[model samples]
Structures are given as structure tokens and as C-alpha cells.
Target chain A: MFVIYCPYCEEHREEEEFHASGQAHLARPLDPDNCTDKEWGDFLYFRKNPRGLHQELWQHTAGCRKFFNITRDTVSYKILETYKVGESPKVNLEDASHG
Target chain B: MDTVNVSNQYATNSVTERAEFGDSNTPVIASALEHANMKSLAVKTATGLGVTLVELPVTGMLVLRARDDKPALAAALKSSLQLDLPNVLASNVVVDNGKSYCARWIAPDEWLLSCPLQDAFEIEQNIRTAAGASSIAIVNVSGGFTTIMLSGNNANDVLKKSVTYDVHPSHFTVGKVVNTVFSKAQVTMRCLDTNHYEFIVRRSFADYVWLWLQVASAEYGISIEIE
Candidate 1:
């Protein structure tokens, strides 16, 4: 049984306490009102699902009630980083060694 | 023409200021939960500041919402209480010095500040002066919340069980403040000192958090600090 660290609670709790939110650091367009329908649709729905390393956002809805970024390998299930709600994720997959 | 002593049967239970009503009494009251293994762990600052670990009985908490754009409100708060309002994930300290204080912040045009059982009036006046007519509201949450102070060698361990925020030394250093969840309930956590932390929670959920503390501290053998 593995546990995930909750950035808000400061503890590594059972994975059940957290829900994985994919991809952090999304910025809303400055002028969403003037965007085309396709642009808005792509912004809202597109995601990068890589097989190796992935940068994702996770919300501790059952725990901290805050959002954090997690850099982990999908195959190995190894978490690289967990950052705060407003901060940026500091993971670079190219520099990291994946198992 | 001033000779009327009206009998107030209704006034007995209707104390307008909840803090003053409970002021004469003590603030920290022990709980009466029956369990075969009623274990507790209380910790305090290494420096031995009155920073203690306690599970407060029935208390009230309110989440104050206000617009930081209002200059009058900010000025009023500083002048009356000497409290610097916190913005976003930040928090401020309110005290004559470091001895006593009530840290507050701006949570998206709103602020959450807590004080002793009876300091609501002064807090109200100060807020009114600072937040002059700029779409601000103050709701008395005296009957809604409670407080718990966690201190000691393993208080952080207990907190780690319920909160998802990083409480590591690098992330949650002394004087850090966070509004997070404790178990299933939401709580505002403030690090008062190196080994001490304070949590503000709803009255209805106090029991749940307490039970959580008990279970979380099973390995640490929590020491209850009774007043």
C-alpha cells in the first residue's frame, strides 16, 4: 500500500484521501471573450497524456482542500515533486531519470 | 420619570455578546467522550511560551469576508487593533506585542480572523472603521466554531494525518498559516512556534477532529495537557 503526500496537511496519507487532477499551471487567456469557438474548445479539453513522465495537478479534496502539482512517472508511479497551489511546478522530464 | 425595573426572564439566556458571556468562565474545557482507549497528545513550544496543546470545548468561529480595496477598512483595522491584514495565502499578526494575537488574511476579498472568547466587540469596531462602505460584511460566527492548539514532539505528525498541505520544515516553517481540511472538515492552521500549531474548526466537527487526533497519535502516545 502506497501513500501520497498532501501539500496542505504536511503528511503522506493513503492515496484514497486525494484525487488526481491532471496538468497544473494552466493560464486563462487574457481575452477569452474574443476567442474563436475552436480555440476555447481546445483550451478547455486538450490534455497531454504521455506514457513516461507526466506533470499533473492534484487536489486534496478529502484532505487539504488545496490544489498542488505532482510530477510523476506513469509506469513507475514515482512522484518527483509536489508544489503549492499558486506556485509553479519545477519538474523537467528531460533532466530527470525515469525507471 | 425614570423608575421602571423591568424583569428580564428572556434576557437571562440571551446574552448579546457570546464572548463576554463565556469570559468569566474558562476557555479550554475537557471533553467527555467515553472510550476504552481515550488517549491524547498535547505539545508546546520549546521556548515554553504559553503556547499549549488543548482541545477547546464548544466554541464559535466565523470566516470574515471583506474587500481589501477599501482603504478605510485597512486604516481602521490598523489604527484600532494594530493588525495588518493578510493577502491571499499570507496572514498577519494582531497583538500589543508577541504575547497575544489574532492573525487574519484576505481570502479572495474576504478575511478570516480569530480572537479570544470575548474580543468580538473591539474587533467589530475596528473592522467597521477599516471597511467603510466598500461592499464588506461581518457575520458573528461565535456559535459556529472551535479552536485546538497542537504542540509537542509529534503534533506535526498528528496534523499530517488530516491535512494535505506540506507541513515539512521547509514548507510550513514557523509562523506559516494555511486554511486546509482536518479529516473531513475544513480548518485554518497557524504555526505559532516551532513545535506548536493552532487549528480553528467548526463546533459540530470538533469531536471528529479530536477523534482523528486520538487515532493519529496512537504511536506517539499523546499527552493531554489539562488545565
Candidate 2:
């Protein structure tokens, strides 16, 4: 069980209160009508299954009921940093591996 | 402390409006625990015990939610009820303003406020008036949930077995509230004082929570105080 720190609630809560909403920071095409079929398919179905480090979108389902991002190590399950939505992650694959 | 009885505020309001929900004074409302029929079970459990369990006589409970503009509504609630929104989890609660109405933090943007049953409607209207066009939601959930108090020497032990959250005195204290998993269910817990903990569970989960507590506390003791 992982303990996640909610940036908004400012506390480390049990992971049971949270839900992983999939990859974070994925930008949508500016003009969806002009996008090729492949581009739309990629946006809808494509996601990174990283090995060492991963950035994930998580929602605190039980506690604060807010969405945030988590920079975690997939292999070790160590959370490097948790930031709110629209905010940047302090740790990513580059510096996250060392962390 | 959240001062001012939230119900009393409704009594003096000059709005002169009928309750949106039925007038609570004569409504035949039944709590979720009504399915469990705890009254007789409580009588049988209280024979000779150390710790005591009581279904607290709570009148009305409102789930208050606020979004982007939280402080505006919080300030309105504070002025109308004299209770500031608890800024942190498990450290501050506007419980027992010495007038029966109490409030607890459920989430950063959500709070559970309980007051007299007869005045829930008028109070809801009063809060809406106080909020004045702010984006907020006040939901009356009195029949949908209930409060239970567990007190005595082994109360903490029973809690430890039932909830995943740490119940150690060092971590949990008076006026602190937490939303955590209780076995397979969810509950909002508050520490009222030493060896005394309060639980706010949905009516649908009330029987499950009660049964879980019954089995967990059976090893130590079971005492029930029906309100």
C-alpha cells in the first residue's frame, strides 16, 4: 500500500482513497476536426508504459476529492513527488531515476 | 471552536418560507441504521461492559461543498454559524458549540454540519441566503447517515482493528477528523476526547459498520447506550 501526499490537503493519506486516472500532461490536438484518424486514435488509446519511472494522473477519491499528478518509480513503487493538476512535476524520468 | 448553535440561527431568521423538504417536525424519517434494528441489540449488549457504544441523537446533517471560490462560502457559513472551515485534517473541528450544532471537515472543500432536526430546512435557506450567489451546494443527508460514539478503555483497540488509519493517541486527538476506509466500508471519524471516538457512516453502511464493531469489540466488551 502506498501513502500519497495530497498537495491540496497537505497530508499523506492511504492509497485506498485515491484512483489512478492514467497518464498525465497529455495535450489534445488544437483542431480535432483537422486531425488525421491516426492522431485521434493515438490521443485516445496511446499511453506510455515506462519501466523505471512514470508520471501518473491520480484522484483522491475518498479524502479531498481532488485530482493531482504523481511521479513514481514503477519498479520500486517509490513516489518522488505529487503535484496538483495543471502544475509541473518536480521529478520525471530524467532526474527521477537518480531519486 | 465553531460557536453559535446553527439551529438557533434559523429560529430568528425573517425569511418566512416553507422548508424545501417536508417540514421535519413531523416527518417520519428513518435512518439507514433502521435496517439493523440496534435498539434491542443494544439492550442485550449493555448488560455488563467497560466500553460503551451509543447511537448519538443527531437531528440534521448537511453536506456542504464548495469549489474554486471556497472562502466566500466558508465565510458565509462562519458568519451564519460562527464556525470557520477547518483548514487542516484531524486537528480542528467546530464540534459542540455548546448548543448541539457541530461541524467536521470531510474534505478540503466539504464539511458535515449537524443541527436540530426541526430546523434543518430553515437553516439550509439561511445558509443559501448567507452565501449570496457563490457557487456552493448544501445537501441535507440526515436520513442518509448517522453518528455513533464509542467510548471507554478499549475503544481505541476496537478502532484499530476496524479502521486502517492510525488510532494511536499520538496521531489522533480531540477535534481531529479523517475520512478513511473502515474495513470494507468508508467512514468519517473524529476524536471527541480521550478514549472517545465518533464515527459518521452512511445509512447503507451503518449496519455493516456496527456488525464489524460488534465482532471486533466482542473480544473486549460490548456496551450499548441507545439515545
Candidate 3:
């Protein structure tokens, strides 16, 4: 099992205590009334199933019960970094692939 | 606009009546494990017992939540409770006038404060008044959970076999508290001493935890103590 770091708890906890919410950083449309159906549908239902580096939202369900972000390599099953809710990840797809 | 008499309604409503005084008709408050029948399993003598398990009597618990006004809340708690807000994964306890008060850090924005059962409502009100104008939430959760003390020589061994988190003394030092999984149920565990540990488990899961402890500590010779 993965030892996931909980940013809020400031400690590494077992993966059994956490739950992976879908993709991270999904912004709602500001002008929903004026937007097209495709945009609204995409916002509601669409999610990226990226093969490489991905940012995902996760909750420490049994521990702190707080949400945070984890940047991980989908293929290698490695977590590159974990950050709090409002913070941004330092690692991106391009930096990881080249380095 | 019509004005409602809230106090009159509350006074006349038997369902919302408060039990301020005890009498022959007033029912005694029982803990969650009161009917678990653990006394039958206790050893008549404590000579060979390796682990001692005791269910603490009813305690007053409050969940304190504050996001942006944490400093204000901390000051308020310091003034009213004479205890500082604990840091991450840590707990603080204070005894004043023979009354013990403890606060365990549950999350970045939440902490659990436990005191004597009879003082819970007064403490909640005191904190609210002291933290006036500060954004905070104090919820009385005394009846929602119970504390279990696991101690003796092989107490750590029983914990190692049950919880998923590392319970080694080197990692789980004194004052450190963790909310982790214990035999499929969630428990907030705290290390009191070398071999002493305290668990706060939900009332609904108290029976399950007690049964699990009995089975896990069977090989080590478990004994129950009534408080």
C-alpha cells in the first residue's frame, strides 16, 4: 500500500485512510447562463484520463478528513508530490519526462 | 411579522426537557459498553494479566472548528480553559481544581476537547462567550463517543496486531494522537506512556471494538476493570 502524505496532518499515513477524488482544479463556468450546452456538459461530465503525470484530488477520509492534491505518475504509480488545497504542485508533465 | 415565544415552547415541550436534577425517577446515564458484560471475563486476580482494559466513565466532548480566526479562538480557549491549542498530531492536558481537561488535535482546523461530563455545557457556553465575534463552531459530542484505556505489559503488542498505523514507541511517542483504522473501525488513539494507550471510539462501534480487543489480547491474558 502507498504511504500517502497528508498535508494537513503533516505526516505520512496509510493509503487505506485516504480516498481518491477525481481530477483536480476543475473550475466552474462563471457565466453558466450564457454558455453553450457542450461547455456545460463538458464541465459536468468530462474528466481527463491522462497516461502520464496527473494531478488528482484526494481526501484523508479516516485521518484528518481534509482534501488535498497529489501529483502522481499514472503508469509508474508513483506520487511525485503532495500539496494543500490552495497550493500548486511544483512538478509538471514536461519537467518529469525530460528529467 | 409574528413573534414566537421560543422559551415558552421549550418549557412546555417534554421531549426537549433537560434533566438538571437527579431523583428516583431520573434514569442513570450508562456508557456505551455498559451492557457488554465484560466483568464476567475479568480475572479474579490480576497476578498473571498481561493487558488491562478499562472503559472510562462518560466524558464531556466538544468538537471545536475554526478556519480563519484560529488565533482568536486560541486566545479565547486560553482565557477560559487555561490550556493552549495543541499543535499538529499533538495533545495537551491540564488539571485545575481536580478537574482534568484535555484537547486533542484532530485536524488543521479541528480539535477535540474533553472534560468532566457535568461541565460540558458550561464549558461550551464559556468558550462561545469568550470567542465572541470570532468565526468558530463548538459542538457538544459527549454522547457520540467513548474512551477506552488499554494498558499493561502487552498493551503495545495488542495494538500492533490491530491498527494499520505504526504503533511502535519510536514513532508513536507520548502526546502524539492519530485518527487511524483499528480493526476496520476508526479510532483516535493517543499514547499516554510507555505501554499505556487511550482510544476514543464511536459509541456505535464500542461493542465491536471491545470484542476485537478481547480476541486480540486473548493470547496475552486480557483482564477487564470496571470504573
C-alpha positional error of residue B53 in candidate 3 after TM-score superposition, expressed in Å:
0.6
Best by lDDT: 3
Evaluate residue B191 in candidate 1 and report its C-alpha lDDT on the 0 to 100 scale. Answer: 82
TM-score of each: 0.57, 0.86, 0.91
- Over B1-227, each residue of candidate 3 has an lDDT whose tens digit, in order, gives 12211122112434335455322222234789978765665546364489989999888888999999999889889999999999999999999999999999999999999998867777877787788878888887888899999999999999999998989999999989999999899999999998999999999999999999989988988778887
Question: For model 1, how does the per-residue alpha-carbon lDDT over A8-53 read when each residue is reduced to its tens digit?
Answer: 5566756655688777666666789998888788779888778778
> Which regions of candidate 2 are displaced past 4 Å?
A95-99, B1-24, B90-98
What TM-score is obtained for chain B in each of the predicted models? Answer: 0.72, 0.81, 0.88
Off by over 4 Å in 1: A1-99, B1-13, B16-53, B57-62, B68-70, B97-99
Docking class of 2: medium
The number of the candidate with the highest DockQ is 3
DockQ of 2: 0.70
Clashes of 3: 0
RMSD of each: 9.4, 5.7, 3.7
Better of 1 and 2 by lDDT: 2
Q: What interface RMSD, in Å and to 1 decimal, does model 1 have?
A: 6.3
